[model samples]
Target: NRAVMIGGTTGILGEWGPESEENRYEGAMTARQALAKSKNGATVRIGMTVGVDPVIQLCHAAGIRSPLRPFPATFLGSSEITLAELALAYTIFPNGGWRPNAPHILDRIEEKDGTVVWQSPEDRARQTVIKPETAYEVHSCLVDALESGTGRAARAKFGLKKFPAAGKTGTAYDFTDALFAGYDSSITCAVWAGFDKPQKIYSGAFGSEIALPIWVAVMNAANERYPAKEIAEPKGLQKVEICTRSGLLATDKCYDTVKSSSGESVHKRTTYVELATAAQMPTEPCNVHGEVRTRLVRDLPASGFPRASLAVDPKQVSPITAQGPVLLAENDPYNAVNSTLKPKPPPEKEKPETPSPKSSEETNLPDPTKPVLKAEAVEPDSTKPAPKAEAVETPATKPVLKAERVEPDSTKPVMRAEAVTPTPQKSPKQIRRAEPVHPSDQIPEEDILRPTPPPPSNPDD
Candidate 1:
């Protein structure tokens, strides 16, 4: 059976036998240990892996005439079988893969005068059903069970240590049946203890507690006359060392360290169980142990103390997260965190000290003390002949500046402004009475050199 406490799965089938603290899972062990201890989970896992069909085919060849249901639970002996059929199947292991004849008591029958009428066969022939190596391996496992496993009760409880024997114990799911089936070199026996109504025996009524004592008593009395002996080792079989925990080959490091008397460290070796055949042994060493070593760092902390080293399994290290701080490239666009935490500086605003040449505020500002110029509309004489207008005559649009005006052409009537020299000797009253010219009435370039007109005569005079 495979080790169920390790990688084997029970699905939903929980504990099947008795409930006790001693029946709790104690982790993985060798197949021999699992078979000897009658571990239901381990046997179920093995049956599932090996398939129920193969086990059924093997049982049929070994003379087990019972019918088995097509289910994984059949690995735990879910099918029912009579004691004679079970005992007949077990005889194959002792007889080297051959079934023995059925039990018979009568030798012959005489008809009224001591005359032989019907006689049984002098020698009962056996049939070769399975390979000798297969039977030998199974027998070896049962022997180991009796030595230091659940079947140890044979010697402990029944005082049956004189015979060299091998056996297996069986129990139903709800304590309905308890059985003990075993054999020595000469004889084989099977015992069963249970209620006729198929009810629970007790809380912890196991096969060892209920049936093994009776089987031991029968074997003790039977072996005294038969004289028990060991079976010959079958050919095509070899022994190999295997690790108990992993069921693999033992490695050099599969031992614990202990201090010797001279303070030197010594390795206390682990137990190595041998399998029955070379085909049953493992090829790989146990992988549960790992190596540990110290590594050097390039930089130390500012505290001037060595950094504490932590041991990590090499298989579990990730390429992205197992390293120290990472240095990002300058053009890396991906950000690991929010950008709001590290706000960028606002763009610098550019302002020049000198003003531009085309600024209107610099060129249009006028001096307050300068005399203002004014534009006047000139009236042409109605008697004189006027000149023809030029083809490229200037447009009469209003000027935008306060000191400028549109000069008139000779043919078209227009308003013109004439320049006047500032009066050097003007009375205070005339200066106070002078009016300022608006920007809309400024003088044009063509009338800048014209003579100023005389003051208008008041009509009141």
Candidate 2:
């Protein structure tokens, strides 16, 4: 269920992003399966693995004359080509890796007087582009495409299943163009549907819906004209059963089972045989089921004791018996506590004594240890008689002045201005807002002007 990367980049490539049409994750499909299903992500992965130059060279060898960019997207038909070039390219597969010369408009020209005026050149040598086995492998994949993949409509809907035909269906971006390229033993053909100026043809306009029907119609006539022959499997290619989940050699454990309502078990095989070149044969077995560890058993002489008697019956045992004293006699640290064979009884808790009732007079008496507070003196009656002022003699000696620390009154509010140190207020930090810059603006002038590296070339081509 992991997402596949396109062009080995982390970000999306917009509408050009390669993905499976079903929008579902299909784990570990073989190359043939990828080709048959037209898996864009898988195709790009294979192309990237093989490198851009080699892919371009292979296209050239297949007779594609159009200029192809050395970009990874080219694997998914990002580069455009003419129908003629595509048709010619498909010839190498059915022609056993031999690319035939360009077709002539006329075989020969004859005059009314029965004299041959001109004729097309003969004895043109066909180039060997790929090995026969490689071509056959690709042909088998194309055959799978017709039988079960994108081109299956040709067989299911168009009634083109009688002959052994191999083909592929291609739909351009946004359904701008649709094409079906295929071949049988005798003839190769390609059908394309699109306007000169590319534009959306219609909604859901796949090649199978638009172009395959026409190709099938043409092939129906060709099938009648030429006898159907089986595509021969070339030497050095063999069919090997491989695990669909791991793409490795199938093992006994590489299958699953399902149960039906009737209590019947159905074993679904996860392996299928597919054509692979000798060098491409699987070297390792399927690891998908390797982690299942089986329990091992061994036989030995029976014991003299009865097996039934060895079993412990928890139901018959009492809770006390099941959970006996935690500490044994020998392990007990307190001998006094374990004097009796039975568990010791818990000790009784002490009861608090109640105080005797006191007399009401004693209850009202103030505590002698506590300090007594004196009542304030009442002001003398203002209307009472005033006493004559008496002259008193001044004290013989001056009273010594004593400095005494006085406690602050509890009723009055105390000023703690010095106790509370002023808290320093922190200034808000300034965040410099940087203006958004375009990605192109960040690139250096030299880098922007630098020319793209030339695409690699094949010496053999």
Candidate 3:
């Protein structure tokens, strides 16, 4: 069954993000830990690896989009979306792997003394895009999240333990958005707290602190008010103990053994948690490597030391928002947050496959010596869709950028072409396709001057 995983980094990478001078925070964390900690780096890594298109496609299918561009951070609530929309989209996960529109209700059929009416049939379509196991796995990790990690405060404050629960919290950039979303086998609920005029919340505000308590309150009220019957836990599930740090089976030296509600340690018996989520928790140090080390410390913070990354800093999610053209693609923010990109090597003298250009062409185009993107025709269409595959784009259209993306692009030209030969300047209509800059070689004259759409940006050399 197909599944839709949500809540990704909107640009705030914590430990998992590549080290940078500006993005100072780095500490070892697993996916579960990253999510639990609301680590920016971990979320970005997961979203990029899984491919933003899949999750976002699901959100759009479920009708969710914010003013923020479709960058990686959008998955993290960096974008502006209504609380109502957020609630609706998250409900998809618990509806047995259904899309936002899956559980369609029919018109109310009524028969009364004064009113008699026939109703249209309900939309009864049911299919599994994701295995029931996948949903269960995601749910289970979230359940632990409320107990351990950042949500621990929520567990204690809200009295949410009355029922088994699972959910995620979000804090958007500038404290613009705060969200708490969770679901059970039978019921799903989500909530958002933010302002209409974009005022930042109290400096320490976050999903767990600002939003979760509200969710718990509503949930308990729901149990009493609506009184929906609980969904049964899936069968054949047994508790097990394993290292929360390394998803591997626990060793005698396991730093922390994950304990289930049954009080069984992961060491003695296996407890069901999210499958991919095992290595994701920061519960303990790695079995073999110990821990991924950097300047960041595992020691709990002192009073003024800052708690959550989102609350501590808004720039974690979006450091360089583009008020103009293109922002960094959510998945490719490696170049965005870190100012010091891997430096390219000096240009080498000669090469054959690249056509040595005439001096005249060189002058007319951008610098052949500098790095620029050139769109090359595909060797062949390996990306072709299978006949049976559901074709996503209909009446194929050219790949073009929307003139007005939600945010401006944050790209920089760290290296210039080695040769003096001018290459084409990238423009809105003509985007450049970036080619890897080899250590010894400069961009070939032919590659720089190719006829294609220019990139939205072209910083002059």
Candidate 4:
């Protein structure tokens, strides 16, 4: 089958645009490789091929309580699932395609008087979801995944290599969640590590790195008591030889010709894999690997032949691109980068230059070169009675004395020369301006003197 292009909103699968380099899985791959490497695009394509309805039905049967809708990312596991549900669901592999009912923590309830009030059922058969052969096939694929694929850390880091087990590692977008679901013949376990609020655990966090270690630790401790065992092969499953390069039945033509040290021609064959179960096993022979042909005879060159040789055309190799998964909310990496790198819009048309206002210090300063003019004071008109004194309280600590100073020009009267006076409202200061001294109002300079210093303190009395 030819590979179909699966594009994501992100730069994954070469979705953003055409370029020499992009994050994508370029060519077709067997279902086994797709599962082993945990490729999202391949998994989605596989789900689509199998039909979305069946996949959703399987999810419901597997105990996923979350609301699910048929969409492209459904198989990619965008929906939320609980740790307990996942652990129970994964038991199908070990239980031979049967979904085990969750066991009771307390099998029986006893009263204080030692009477048993209730007890669990004696016999309950697990619900069969698929055939035993199908489970075995899935188990086999997971076994290889642990052996060499993303779940290899269980063997390499946790020292579970000797234990016979099958498992898969799941990493959520941007490491928001990490999970490891695995099983031996007797026990199935799943481990998850993440915060309630989704956040990146850390840079470069993966399922194998974060969750597999915990699963391995628990499994190791349990195996010490229970002992590790292998899953038994069920009846009706057949074993067949298949080509390793292509997961297809092997043929005699799937061999190459090579010369031995003695110059004798020999047939070099590719490695063969022993696969089981008719549903999972290949039905067609591999066309990729075949016997290589070479000339039966060759002409000998003279001794010490020239080092220079004629150039030969390069062999064509099929192209494939390997890509990693991205967060659903993230924009295409290339597009995001290109958008940032794009030149900024020509600075904003130079704003119409606004005239800056002058500072208060500059505007209020008096001109030094101009002559100062004294204010000319004039007498009040004779006909009008003298204006009464108005006592106004000032808000400040000092009292402000306001007087009407009439200018010489008969136009508008120049009013109110404000004089700062001492507080406590006593002995107000009087400012006398030169008012031409009307003949009838003139007083002797001696009479205008201060009232003689209040007769000195009465020491005689």
Candidate 5:
């Protein structure tokens, strides 16, 4: 015969994701969800935020050896922990955040043969971390978790009588450790399964399988033996049906969900799946950014193009040029400049001559100044550059090596076997100049340069 009375039937697995926003376990799931899943992502976030130090402090306060020994993962059940010490945290939950004495004896005096070494009251005081209700609320979340959540397998496998149960399952990365902790009105106990070498556990097996069934077995046997009173739902909690899909207040439109489970009715309230299928558009996409806003909202125009610029025709036709006519000092576009009518330099000025001062009458004359300027053009520097220089050939030493010779780099570039620093050709002077327009009539430089992208807004910003 088995040593303990088994209460419930053990069942299969339940996943938390594909439903919850954080992918946490449902209706009853709480911090216990972390333990239930052995979730690294969830536990890491919790331990990082809450600090392992505080949990370790609680562990020590609960009369256990330090749990925060190696690293933060120790807070995450990453390090090895004894079953008895693991239950220490649970003791805090039941005792309203106070550490249990776990005290055995006190005030025993000894005779000649049997001696009593000490006689003093054992320390029994509150080691408070949070209010009693806070611990209880967390305890309640765990209890809810056990009822129909990750620990549901235990409840389904064997029904423990008159004793409420709250607990969690733990599995390590690569199935290094599988553990379960369960507690009732009377006692809290824990179980673990792993080889000394931390070998591979059963395929697809977790704490729910390897450890929790044992927890249920042991806790149920203890409950049957002791018969502790069950904990009723606390006064503060109010139950309301929530949509599984939406995670919101249930609505009439939300329909039922069905999942088959071993011919047993597992009634979990879930939302009706919202289905949207794409259809061919009745109209074309807007040209600006290719959105079908008008198709969605009727207030928009039939064609996505914005209403055309108001067709305004001036009373009198004003000739407009792409390069606007220059503005004069009076801000009119008719300004003109004086021109030099001199012919290309005359052939006679190629000869140098004896310099002579001009008469006052000649100096005062504009035409007289023109002829004198032509005489100075005969300087040797005026010789047009040697045409060969235009296609300047670089020597081997000059760093232009044809295919065979290795060459060093020169400041100037070599192209087509010649060193060339080709001077850039200048742009032609503006034939037509611009005249400023009124700001309201101005077409912005930005419009001429580049257009802006449509905004994030439904109707573009």
Candidate 6:
């Protein structure tokens, strides 16, 4: 259950390529939990950890004859393979690490007279592809997937819970294809639904929606003939209580509690038991909780207060009573002695005393000590009448002068004024109009405009 970052782009080529189907950001979960949840980013991380070449080789050994590319994208089913091949590959899990032979149509052929004219070859011996412990672990995870994860509809919605079976649900990119491949001790089955030309079937068409039902129906029919049985736990495996948060041996502090929106406790429990091989069993107690507490203790004294001064009555601070349920973040304490103590609640505010309402007369009265001045009356002289205010006429009050309309003489030709286009001014300053020449000045226009020539030859004069 160690934290793994999920739903981010990862690949050698570009920023946009290879993203998880569901964009989860981060979570603390086991590989089995990751598998059950069908987390693409977690799966890609596993593939990178395991290396792409080994994964392809493992697939080949498990009966996937299809060619797989050596790339991280292949970890999320970028390579194409038939449903039959996939179902055959799943056989390795229930078969205790042994890869089964290719499925055949007939076990043997016989003549009509009951004398065998021809017969099928002897069954090929299964190949041991992986350790039994490894297979059982994967088988357990697949069972979890069927019971609670992507294939949960097979049990909850389709009523297949009674049967002991395990499977995975698959939905292709853009929901173009939906598939379900599963197996029991009795038989293996695979189902697929999609268009012949490879177009989207419909929006939100997941394998659990489209193909798991078919797989469930087929498995139910097969169960009648084969009588499905629980897959046996193989040897050399141990069960240990593991912290779901840290994936280490669980300690008392490794418990978790869930609360309702109203802050009521909903569920509370410590770690869950999980199967692990002798080599994989956790040796260390969960440090995540311990570290969190230690950090809180180390930082408390530095917060400008002595540890002794911060002590509180444990009876009043019981997490179960005061807080309902204690989450990891809420489990703040310096040591085991103080573990029951919770953070102090904010102080209650004191209510202000309401002022008495004042009477209207008292509120309206002026202060008696302050001087009150009154307006003085002035006597007017007998001979002088009060000066009258002059009437000031504004534009709106002023009378407008109207020009009289004169009738034009019809006998006289009326000259029409031609419309003139004004030339655009280059400069912003207004041009001054030339002054009209006086009629009394009879000088020639050229002589007036020309500069008077200096009297010819002052020397000759």
Clashes of 6: 0
lDDT of 3: 0.55
Please provide, for model 2 over 97-196, each residue's C-alpha lDDT reduced to its tens digit, 9 standing for 90 to 100.
8987775457788999979998888946798889999899889899999999888889789988588999998877667888899999998899999998
**Candidates' lDDT values, in order?**
0.68, 0.73, 0.55, 0.68, 0.53, 0.71
**Candidate 3 residue lDDT tens string, 1-461:** 01112221333332233211123343455565566655666677678888877877766656565544667866565656666666666565566455444433455667676464875565555544454555556565676677775667666776774666678877665456677887665557778787778787865467788888988887777776555445444443444455554455454554545787888886433222334333333464335434444634566647756665444653433333223332233233342323322246789986655444556744566556556565443333446643453335545465633343232234633344343434355433546799867665354444332223446675762
Residues 206-323 of candidate 6: C-alpha lDDT, one tens digit per residue: 7888999999888888788899888889889988999887777888777556887999976555578899988899887887765553322444445786556547775544232222
How much does candidate 1 score in TM-score?
0.54
Model 5 quality (TM-score): 0.42
Best by lDDT: 2
Candidate 5 off by > 4 Å: 1-40, 52-59, 62-64, 67-72, 102-121, 158-162, 232-461
- Each model's TM-score? 0.54, 0.58, 0.46, 0.53, 0.42, 0.57
Model 4 residue 155 lDDT? 78
Model 4 alpha-carbon miss at residue 153, Å:
1.1
Alpha-carbon lDDT of model 4: 0.68
Q: Pick out the ten consecutive residues of candidate 3 with the lowest summed lDDT.
A: 1-10
Candidate 4 lDDT by residue in tens digits, 348-439: 77588565575785556555455445555567676876676788887898978877745356776767555433232233355778765547
Worst 10 residues of 2 by lDDT: 320-329
State the lDDT at 29 in candidate 3: 51
Error of 6 at 388 (Å): 52
Better of 2 and 5 by TM-score: 2
